[model samples]
Target: MWSYITSIFGYFFKLQEDEGREKLLIEELIDLKLELEREEFHNQNIENKVQESSQQSECFQRTGFVTHCGESYILIDGSFYFDTSACSFNLNVNDKILYLGYNNSNEELVIVRILQNEGIGWENEDDSEEQRFDVINHIIVGIVDCREDRNVFIQGGDLKFNLDDVQGTFIPIAGDWLEMQCSIQKNDEKLTDINMTQVLQVTHFRPLRTKIKSGTVTEWSGKVGIIDNQIYFDSSTFIETFIPQVGAKIKYLRLIFNAMGLPQPKIGTVEEFQGQERPIILITTVRSTESLIQQDIKYTLGFVNSPKRLNVAITRAQISMILFCNPHLLSTDSLWNEVIMNAVNNNRYMGCYFPIEEK
Candidate 1:
């Protein structure tokens, strides 16, 4: 009888000990989670500081017309004298240039040839079409109406291209632009015995997409609250939700609505924000398709594949950049995978698929 009683006591004691250990483990896990969150916040703050400092160090690109030039310096718009020491070529008065250099101690611009210029009466219309033809940047306007194959037309200044042989990663649309290298070549067949000029192959097509993809619609209040310095929607759907009716006025801001009635923040797609910067940016990577991996891959994968677009998205943030995305989905791509790895290494990443070190 004593042995039986002792055995029961021992079992109860073991049960109590097991329960105590389990409680201790739960407490430890909670502590670890809180610590990780703090670490992630700290790491992200550090990255923001580094980015801000780096941007402050570099000079922003500027465009102004040259008013005059001395033997040593080029005067821009009769106000600023930019150092011409590094200019391999000479600049005359009234010349327009894109200058990419920093201001010196005297607050004068020291420039190099990051320039693009178009002067008054630069081209003569009387000149032969072939003579006027040269390679340059251009924007797609619309498709030309023809009984033959539908050909897209592009225009830049006096230059125009009937892009019959157009091919690109994305479909050609009106307002899409590209920086191309082109030339005018005479066609063998003549129009009424007159030699006809045609635009040659567009050697380079800059990947530009202005059309916003469809984004997941969040609560109305959530969208409204997020309106700040700069907001980037991964799609047009999200944009529509916030700015529902065109020209419909609602009061939360001191802002007036445009004809389109969009918010004050610079709202655009990831692709449209190329070569653009903002003090703060929020990127919402929306995934709403049923086949999340396959269908969304067309759009989401595009973001991951193009290094240029990624570069623009990341570097645009001068102060801070917040990415609203499912890391697991993004991790499938190589570029995004690298980002994940970097975030993990820096202790900035948090997700279910990857292991987080408690230490």
Candidate 2:
């Protein structure tokens, strides 16, 4: 009897110990789970804060234009843009920098004060320009369509491209009304059919000389593919494009419209159609496309003097719609819907005769 009672007690004690061990293990598991959840919560909070801060980031953060002339860096993106002198820095290709030292200096993008990401990899901006023609720095080759009222062109080069005729700014129109001071030149002097001289001045706009493909012809649809890049004829040599990619102090800005609203243009003056093919409503007096690019800033507004001059200039916009408003006036209609038909019914002609009128 005594042995049986002792064995029963031992068994009971062993069972209690096992239960205690299991309870302890369960508590430990619960504690570990709580700790894991805490870590997750903390991480989520940090992420939320980061996202909030990023959302608050400014949309129109202005930066200075950068140019490297020898070892000296030139800040040339502003109207009164100049860097006290050519300041020297161990400038690299990519740096998310700001210029604060030159305040009230009339420079949009000024200094190297607040480097984003605390000076980490900043090469992301190099891939900004999407145009294949961007890398080709063209020189002012020749001037064309030189007459009394509109005396512009580089010289000798092809201006068969009606500045008022190109689907873009110049050829389709007279000019973009902007100017440039470019440094691109060709190696062959004999290739001097295009005469790019005059230091730098306001000139008509035209598209850069593109090596059109050999067996390609522009479809009525106005689409060109990569295979068609082999053979190129100067349509300007033939017809002409108004978007001047060559010779000028700078290229006009290709304005991208954010929405449906019209923005103003910087045409030196406004006028009626010069008997050209384009619509007359927004006809901007001929200007340089290069200079347009220089003037684009957030909230920048001006009127396009002559909507016809906007032929190539308006087409330069790659992404958004660029509304070329009147730099001087904001009339009800920025579009030339009336002129397209009026030329046909009424005897008023711009740059060239209207086919609609003939019909």
Q: Which residue segments of model 2 deviate by more than 4 Å? A: 58-359
TM-score of each: 0.27, 0.19
Model 2 Cα RMSD, 1 decimal: 29.6
State the lDDT at 53 in candidate 1. 32
State in Å the error of residue 71, model 1: 68
The numbered model that scores best in TM-score is 1
Give lDDT per model, in order. Answer: 0.47, 0.32
Please list the residue runs of candidate 1 whose C-alpha ends up more than 4 Å from where it truly belongs after superposition: 1-263, 288-290, 297-302, 350-353, 356-359
Error of 1 at 115 (Å): 48
The residue-by-residue lDDT of candidate 2 on 184-236, one tens digit each, is 12223222122232111122232434312122232211221111211112312
Candidate 2: residue 199 Cα off by (Å) = 43
